[model samples]
Target chain A: MSDDLIGADGRKLTFDANQIRDLLPHRWPMLFVDRAYDVIPGKSGYGIKNVTVSEPYFAGHYPDQSIMPGVLIVEAMAQLTAVVYASAWKEEVADSDEVDTAGRVGYLGAIRQMKFNRLVVPGDQLILKAELGKAFGTLTPVTVQASVGNELVAKGSLTVTERGSGGGNGLQ
Target chain B: MSQSYDELLDQAQARASLNLRVKVLLVDSLGLEIQAELIGDDQPLFGRGLELDSLDTLEIVVMFEEHLSVTISDDDRAAFGSVNKLVDFVVAALGEIPRVEALA
Candidate 1:
């Protein structure tokens, strides 16, 4: 496949569902992001999620109104954050001969000051954006937002523990 | 002319107020279950005291930047020793109790 997805920094800027699958451990019903692009390792990333009526949550979310749950939008943003970190980690290990066979699994340390502006619905594509802040040890501070076109859907800051940091059943 | 006694008293009061603010900020930013007053002014922030880990340190860094308008770089790890140490660092950085408008 002649994939010219490299960005100005010579790092891969785009990832399709297949590429996303290789980085994230989430499977169907939990995997929220369909395409991730504009990924600047260790700094920022953007993602796209095409909302459809066929989503499992839509069946019981309203049963008639079909509004996407706000939490899921935040989840999509978190997944994009995972991409940002995982991509950076990949770059860090790229020059080494070591092969990392572990599937990336990140956990949310805390979801702080999240505000929802509008409800998402079928046919609306969620534009996910995440800006990574400073990282101390395994924890990184990230500001994330999800929007549908020009309308804002949700915005928040999250403390994300990097993949394989070993936090079992606890948020922090 | 040396500083007056009243001026020295005023400076001490200002430092104490900043210490309280920093303690309150630590509790609020870290989502600590305990009250701000419960935290001692000289209590060690990590290990044997508040038992804060690296994640909590990051939270404090963000909190200081947002609320105190002070940057806590890697070299400034010494300030994380205690609440008093953190307040002293802020006072030294800002050269005063951070003004109310600085809080975001």
Candidate 2:
């Protein structure tokens, strides 16, 4: 909600858990989306997740200390990509002949070349960004990078499939 | 269905306490940042208020895996929408392991 949120392109984006909940149906113990910023729907989006010690994984992780896992980093990135496409093309889907399918069907089709540059830990905030990668009919791929400050944490690519009226199987 | 939400919350909170304690032990035992309100129990760990962003999220994810050895599914990783929702989900997820194993 700041003037600066809009990059030079002027397309603005944002989301909260309530919004994410409506978009996706992963309940407690799942649903890894928090808030999104500067999302351009079909083109790109930025997602944010606040890391904390109050996570279940920490109890069994170390008992004494907790560190974030690498796999989750990439998962977070994928979730952000879904948000991007939803924001980008939701309206078009709604207006098209398949509005019903558009309601709950953004799928991450694939992920590639995942590399974690650094370790993630408690109290660290993760910012995931996605941009257009490649497109082929219903499937679109994206380039994603996660970072803290100037340091890169992870980088990879993800592909997503859109849903029209009949395709109601939303991803978790 | 599982033990209970309250039970899970307690479990997550206890671990969270340990993490904070460690943060204090390693970085700020003196509570210096306390004066500036650098971090708080309810402050937003990422974005404008605390300005955490991506790396922080990854750090938490790493911490969970390193300490718990439980992999957060793409479905459940670094989630924070409402403090209540986050704590609830984490506790439930952590507690579900016993049940999952019992089923096996």
Candidate 3:
């Protein structure tokens, strides 16, 4: 329960890409989340997505004019949720060195009440947040909200299942 | 093997938390600025009138992985065109499975 979580520069986890990869299971073009700040496992986490005209999706989304899509907003939320679960796993298993995410994936069970409050333009920075609504080992209930400052963009809740069972996260 | 729209929609919404979480992850992780809203449970979440576009769909494909923990096949494109369709797909895939989160 930290009000202000700091990063390497004592700034915050807001600008840590290396940490992002370690937590998330995504690659280029597909990966939308850029920085996750104010992260507190199993509680709440805040992240950002920077939309740009240079994105490949913009090429055909509408050559004349590029606009950020709505679905992507959902994806960003899911990723942040994964971090919450993953970080929780790390915290729980920190005592024992027995948990690896290699050769595995997290499955999305469902999304509920997804709404697009505004359009994410080429340069707008989307602020995504996740609050672990319900957590029980591997099966967690996640609630997400995406916004740009004070504006609420989208929100939903879904189930998550981490693959390749082993370690402390496994259900009994 | 086709289910009613109502059945499909219910299945989808009952499927996964990451489905919504990953979309949040990518947008913020990659530094993409975007916005999304809640379409009616009965509303169409795809195509004209909706904020989502073609590329937005592609990102959804990626979102499938980051959130659902499932790899969307090439054939899945059409199924996810509508939010209702995606929910149906999710319901069909992971809804039945007894999920217990485990480390890889």
Predicted model with the maximum TM-score: 1
Q: For every candidate, what is the interface RMSD in angstroms?
A: 3.8, 11.4, 13.4
Model 2, runs deviating above 4 Å: A1-10, A93-103, A168-172, B1-104
The residue-by-residue lDDT of candidate 2 on B1-104, one tens digit each, is 68798988875666565435323421232223443223454555456544543323333343345444434344554454323334445556667422211110
Root-mean-square deviation of candidate 3: 16.0
TM-score of 1: 0.82
**Which docking band does candidate 2 fall into?**
incorrect
Tens digits of lDDT, candidate 3, B35-94: 322333334445443445433444455556566665556566656555446655765777
Per-residue lDDT value at A97 in model 2? 46
The sequence of per-residue lDDT tens digits that candidate 3 reaches over residues A3-89 is 345544442334255667776668888777787777766677888788888988888877888977676678778887776666666
lDDT of 2 by residue, A1-172 (tens): 3436455767776777776665554555555667878777678878887778886767777688687777677778877777776665555765664333226556666564578897777888888898864344445657899987678999976656665445643222
How do all the candidates rank in terms of DockQ, highest first? Answer: 1, 3, 2
Alpha-carbon shift of residue A160 in model 2 (angstroms): 2.6
Measured by TM-score, how close is model 2 to the native structure? 0.53
At residue A106, candidate 2 shows an lDDT of: 61
TM-score of candidate 3 chain A against the true chain A: 0.79
Instruction: Write candidate 1's Cα lDDT for B1-104 as tens digits.
Output: 78999988877777777777787888888888888878999999988999898778888989888877888886788999999999889989987775442222
